[model samples]
Target: MPRFMGFVRMEEGIGMPPQSLFDAMDVYIGEQAAKGVFLDGGGLYGTEDAVNFVVRGGEVSRVDGPYAEGKEVVGGWSIMQFDSLEDAVAEQEKFAQLHAEHWPEVTVVATLRQISDGPEAPGD
Candidate 1:
């Protein structure tokens, strides 16, 4: 089985999803959890209090968030394991559809990436 992380990205100041979407997601996530496909997941607060430590040329610098230039941010994420990529894609489609049906006014990107198993890549 392969494990993948899926997350949704939205505009920086976009508010939270509506209660109807929340209720619908609960049911969807519950079903996946019951099948042991969902591992762990949750929503994150906005970047208002976020901090980043950047390193360059052997020096570390801190950057505080509520970033004025950042146009998008991750809103929620899920870690899941599935028998195959196809299965995962199918599930992701359902997740995205829920947003399209419930929160039709806002645009969001549902991204899925397979978790790396070897080693971390060097950053530039």
Candidate 2:
């Protein structure tokens, strides 16, 4: 089986999602976990207190958020396993649909990418 990483990105200061969205997500995630398609996943806090190390030239520096730069940031992520790429994509689509149906007032971008365990093949 292959594992893919899914990320949900949105504006950082948009506040919390509606309760209905969380309720719907609980049911959906529970079903996925029962089927073993959902490996591990959870929502993330905003970057207000986040810390990062950056390298500039030959020096390293520490940066703190709310850095006041980007409007969009990753708000959540999940690691999921499926038998094939198609299956993983299908699952992600359903996940995105949940946001569409329940959090219609917010703009959410769900991104999916395979976790590469080795070097890519030619041209890939």
* Cα RMSD of predicted structure 1: 3.8
Per-model clash counts, in order, read 0, 0
| TM-score of each predicted structure versus truth | 0.91, 0.92
Residue 46 of model 1 has an lDDT of 93
lDDT of 1: 0.91
Off by over 4 Å in 1: 119-124
What digit string (tens of lDDT, one per residue) describes model 1 on residues 49-107?
Answer: 99999999999999999888878788899999998888999999999999999999998
Q: Please give me the total number of clashing residue pairs in predicted model 1.
A: 0
Error of 2 at 87 (Å): 0.9
RMSD of each: 3.8, 1.9
- TM-score, predicted candidate 2 vs. hidden true structure: 0.92
